[model samples]
Target: MTKPLIIGVSGASGLIYAVHALKYLLAADYTIELVASRATYMVWQAEENIRMPAEPDQQELFWRDKAGVKTSGILNCHRWGDAGDNIASGSFRTLGMVIIPCSMSTVGKIAAGLSSDLLERAADVQIKEGKPLVVVPRETPFSLIHLRNLTTLAEAGVKIVPAIPAWYHHPKTIEDLVDFVVARALDTLDIDCIPLERWKSS
Candidate 1:
């Protein structure tokens, strides 16, 4: 079974994107190595209206109940310095990596080759190893700094997927829009999915 390394940071504003991605990936039987930023924990409270759980079991339960994600034990959380972790090195053999809601700080770090944390280290390994690295940045009103860093990462072969939801799908709810971007990201990883919409070429 081919498992992709999935990383979620707080920088993604539309938390639903990560949740939906998690749901689909797990359902597809792909084992994921997930890491959440400190800020991501706070954002779930401030934006998505979901509170952080005290225990790892509670965390898994919260995600399962709230986002319909499937996982056994503490599949959703990993320590920052757990370099002992499997996803930390290129030798671990992962198909790809995705950093949903990647922050400008993280983007710049990855672009410049900074691996202070496991998340950063994992991203570096992806780039150095020439594997697919997808970054879903949720910020809007792009600053020139953000654009340049993104372009740099893109040039380095990272898929800088901005969190811009497609309107052509005529989304009735927020979930529809979220699924659209998530499906697109999954597509980059070559994961077969019933994409949120079918394109009609004229």
Candidate 2:
């Protein structure tokens, strides 16, 4: 059986990135092991006007509905509530992991080897196991402290991808922008899913 790809959603503003990425990954038929931080639920309600249920089953239903993925597609997903889940261990092999909209606080925690939650612990496992770990931070006007922490992660072999969309694609809508970032993340994971148009010099 193909190992699943771990997708962690941290507390960040760009919940759409995670939603779109989930859809694309499911469409590509990759089994997903998903975990969301508590803050992710709050931000999803505030930013996307979508409320996620606290229960794992309800949260799975919520994600499937929001991503417009069919029931079978969602069947390929395995949801975990706590950081101590199986994926948090280095022994659990996976294709890789991506933490979309990774909050700066989460970044700092991962950088310092602090696995306070499943998201952070899973990321830590990826790093220690020498697997592809892509972190997409959706913050603007990064402070020096943020830069330093990001650099630390980079030095430790983490792919720090910020959610900065390029206008070169001439994005006409918000979804386009979200696709740009998600596409970059897929690229980093060595996944062949392209959610947006690639830049080609004319």
Best-fitting candidate, scored by TM-score: 2
For 1-202, candidate 2 gives per-residue lDDT tens digits of 7788989899988888998988888777778888888798789789868778777777777777877886544333334457667888999989899999899999999999998777888999999999999999988889999999999999999998899889988899999889888998889877877656677977
- Judge candidate 1 at residue 154 and give its lDDT: 89
How close is every model to the real structure, measured as TM-score? 0.88, 0.93
Error of 1 at 52 (Å): 2.5
Displacement of residue 189 (Cα, Å) in model 2 is 1.3
CA lDDT of each prediction against the hidden true structure = 0.74, 0.84
Q: List the residue pairs that clash in candidate 1.
A: 10-40, 12-101
